[model samples]
Target: MKKILTILMIVIMSTALFACTTQSNNEIKQDLVVGLEAAYAPFNWTVTSISDYSYPISNQPGSHVDGYDVQMSKELARIMDRNLTIKAIEWDGLIPALNSGEIDVIIAGMSPTSERKLQINFSDEYYRSEIVMVVKRNSVYENATRLIDFSGSKVVAQRGTLYDDLIDQIDNVVHQTPLDAYSNLVAAVTTNVSDAFVAELPVAESVVKSNPSLAIVKLEQGYGFESEESDITVSVGMRKSDTDLLNEINSALSQISVEVRNQMMTEAVLRNNESELTLFGLITKYLSLFVQGVGVTLLLAITGTFGGFIFSLVLVFGKTQKIDKKRDNIFKKIIKRISNGLSTAYIVLFRGTPMIVQAMIFYYGVKLITDISWWTPLSAGLIIVILNTSAYIAEILRGSMNAIDKGQMEAARSLGFSRIKSLLYIVYPQAIKNALPAIGNEFIVNLKDTAVLSVIGVLDLFNATRQVVGATYDTVTPFIITALIYLFLTGVTSIAVNYLENHKAGKELKDA
Candidate 1:
C-alpha cells in the first residue's frame, strides 16, 4: 500500500514538473513567437507533414501550419532577423495570448477593427480582402449577388468575430448561433445547418476549392454588409505596449510592396492542400493524427482521474475531520471549521460552474500572474481536470465514508490504533473501495468532458478532429472516426473498471 501511494505521488509530481518544464525557450532564444489558429486555411491550417512553406506548430506535435498568415509571419520574422516560432491558438485566445506575453504577436489574419484597436495595436495591413458568403453550390442563394437576396435565410459566422456581428445587418435573417471555427462554419453550411456563413474572400475560396458542394457568393460592392475599412484589412496584432515592435513590423510590411503581398497570398492559396479522397481514404490518410489525439485524450483522462483520486483523499480528510461539540475544545472546533469550510467551498465552486467556463478562467487567469511559458493547453488542461475532478471525487469519498459503520473506527481505536491510523488504514481503504465505481464513472465522464479543453487549444480527440475537418472541409468522415475512437476508449475503460471491481470483491470474500 505504501509503495502504491508512493508511486502515485511520484507520478503526479513528475507530470506536474514535466508540464512546468515544457515552456518555450523564449528567455534563452531570440525566436519571434507568433500565435494563430492553424485551423483557419489560406490564413492558416494544420498539416500532417512539413513542407518548405510550412512551419511546425510549437505546441501540436506532428503538425505543421501553412497559409498566408504563415507566409507573412515568416517574412516579418526574416526581416526582423529572428527565428519564427508558431503557437496554434484558438481564435478568441489570440488577443489574450498577445496581451499576456504568451506570444510576441498575433499573425492570425485578424482585422484591425475599432474594438480590437482598443485592446491591442496593429501593424499596417498584411493582407486585405472583401467579405463573402459560402453556401451550398446549387442552393437557392448560389447565384445571388446581394445581401438582401438572402434575407430570411439562415446565416452563421465564426464566433467573436466581425462576421458574426454582421449577421444582424441582414433583413429578417435567421442568425444561427456563431460557431467556434471557420471549419465549423463550413460544416454547418455543407450540412444545411445554415443557409450561408460569412467569411473573408480567401477563406471562402479555400473552402469552395476543397468542397465541391459549396460555393461562394460575392455580393456587389453596394449590396454587401457595410464595414469599416479596418474590418476589411487583415493586420498583425500586438500588445499596445509593443509600440516599438509594431513600428518594426510596419516597416517590414512597407518593404513588401503590394505586388509582393499579393504574390505571397496567391502562392499560399495555390499551396493549400485539399483532400479529394473518399471517407475511408481520408481516415487512412489522417490516421496518425487521430491516434495522436487519442493518446493525448487518454493521457489527460487517466492522469487526471488518478491524480484527482489522490488529491480528493486530501480533501476528504479535511472535510471528514470530526468536530464533536461535546468533546472538542474551542481551538479544535475553529480549526476543524476552517478546514471543512475550505473543502466545502472548493467542491461548491467547481461543481457550481461549467468546465468550459472554468477552463477559460483558470487558463487565462493564471497567465496574468505568472510566466505561463510552461502552460500549454495540454498542461493547463491536466491541472484543470485534476482540480475539477477532485471536487466531485471528494464528495464521492465523503459519501462513502459516511456509509462506513461508525463502529469500525471505534473498533480500530479499541485495538490501540491512533485516530489518524484508524482513518488511514481502516476507514479510508473501505471508503475508497466503496467509491471505486463512482470514481470509474468520473473517469468515463472526463473522457468525454475533456473535449471542452479544445477551446484552449488542447489537441485532444475533438480538437484533432476539428483540425482534420479544417484541412479537408469534409466534416462527416473525421467526426465519424472521432466518435468511434471515443466509443472504443470508454468501452475498454468500462470493462477494466468492472474487472477491478470483481477482483476486489473476490479478494474480500476470500479473506472473509
Candidate 2:
C-alpha cells in the first residue's frame, strides 16, 4: 500500500507539474517567466476554464491567470511579442529566484518596500489595497474601531509584509506567528490558529466572498497606522541588474488602468459564506498552505540521513582498512572507484546542484524514460536531502574516524581482532560519541528543512498552517499554532538527543 501510494503520488505530481510548466509553442525570442502566487484570485489562480467567469478575465485563454498583474503581463507580452511564461513560486523564493536569474520578472502582487528595494528593483505601483482585520462574523472585533479595540488580543500577519511590520506598532496586542503568504494567513484564523489576522482589503473582500462564515472588520479612520499601511501597493519586482526587464515591465504597467484591474477581480472571485472549506477552496482563497507541506519533507530528511549514513560507513571502511582475497580485490577496486568518485564528482554534483532541480528530476523525470513512477514524494524528497546530507555526513564520519587515535587501531589489530571488528567495537563507538552533538544539530535542521517540502505538495505543519492563514486571511493565529508545533517538535528532538548523549556516557564511556 505504501509503495502504491508513493507511485500514485509521483504520477499525480508529475501530471500536475507538466500541466503547470508545459509551454505552448507560440514563437518568441526570450522566455519571460513571471512568478506569482497563482492561488490569489482576481489577481491570479488556476480554474477549470476561462468560460467559468461571469465576465472575461483580461482575455486569458485558460482559467489560470487573471487580475491586474495578469492583464498587464498579457498586454505587455502582446507589445513585446515574446513568449511570456508564468512560474508560480512561493513568496519567499521570489526575490532569490529572480536574483539567481531563474525567472525574469516577479509579477506576484508584491509591495516595493524599502528593504525589498535593496535586493531587487521594481516597476511602478500597479494596484494597491488597504490592510484590515478578518474575524468571525459579528465577533467582538467586528466593526470594532481602532487598535485599542483589539488590544491584548492575538494578531497574526504574513512574514515580511507591511502588515507584519505593522503588527508590532500596536502597543499591547499579543502578536502570534508571522505567516509567509495571504493563504496561510486565512487558514490560521479559520482553523482557530489565530484570533484575527491583518490582510489587505482585496484579499479580505475575496475571503469573505469565498467563505461566508468569516467577517471583515474594517478599521475606522485613524486606525493608528501609516497612510502607506492602508495603501498596500503591489508592483512587479525585478533583479537589480535587470534594467532591461525593469524597463519592459514599467512600460507594461503604464498601459493598464484601475478599472480593468477591478473588473478582473470581480470575474475571478466567487462569493461564498460557508463555515467549512476544502483544502482546495482554502488554498485558492489563500496561497500559504504550501508552507506547511510535510510528509515528503520528513521522509526526505530521515531517508536522506539514513542513506548518507550507510553509504558513508561503507566508504569509510574501504578507505581506512586493507582486505585480501580474489573477491576482496574486486571489491577494493569498486570501492576505490566509489571513493575517488565521491571526492571528485558525486560530492560536487549533489552539493552543487539546486535541490529543487534534483527533486523535479526525481518526481517528473520518470515521464521521459518509463511508465513506472519509481519515486514517492517522501522517497524522492529524501533522496535529494540524503544526497546532499550524505556529502556532509560522509565528511563528518571520515573526520571522526581519523580523530580516533591511530594507536587504538594498532593495539586492536595486535590483540588478534580483525580490522572490521576493531572498527565496529573500538572505533565507531567513540566516533559516534564525538558525533552525537553534530548529529543532533542535523536533526533539528532536518525538522526545519521540512518546510521545503511544500514545493512538492506535502501538507505538514507549515503547509497546513499556511492553508489556514490563506483561507481565514488571518496570518497570525495560523502561524502561531504552526510555529508552536515546530518549536515543540524541535524541543522534543533536543531532549531526545540529550538523553541519548547521557545514555551513551553512562553505558559506554562515562561523562556525556
Each model's lDDT comes to 0.87, 0.65
In order, what is each prediction's RMSD in angstroms?
10.4, 13.4
Output the number of the lDDT-best candidate: 1
Q: Write the per-residue lDDT of candidate 2 for residues 1-512, one digit (tens) a residue.
A: 99999999999999987766655333326767676655465465533334432222111222144444566666667676677676555566567556655567887678888888889898888777777888877667777778778887789987877788888777688889797666666666777767788877777777777566678887777775565632478888887888887787777667767787666555445431224555455445434333324443455556767777766676566555444455477867777667666564665676677666665555445423444434434455666677667666666776898888999989998999987899999998788778877877776776786566545433445545543443344455445555765787778878988998888778765433
Off by over 4 Å in 2: 1-28, 39-42, 46-68, 187-193, 229-231, 271-310, 313-315, 318-383, 388-451, 455-512
- Cα error, residue 141 of model 1, in Å, equals 0.9
Give the top-scoring candidate (TM-score). Answer: 1
- Candidate 2, residue 35: Cα displacement in angstroms equals 1.3
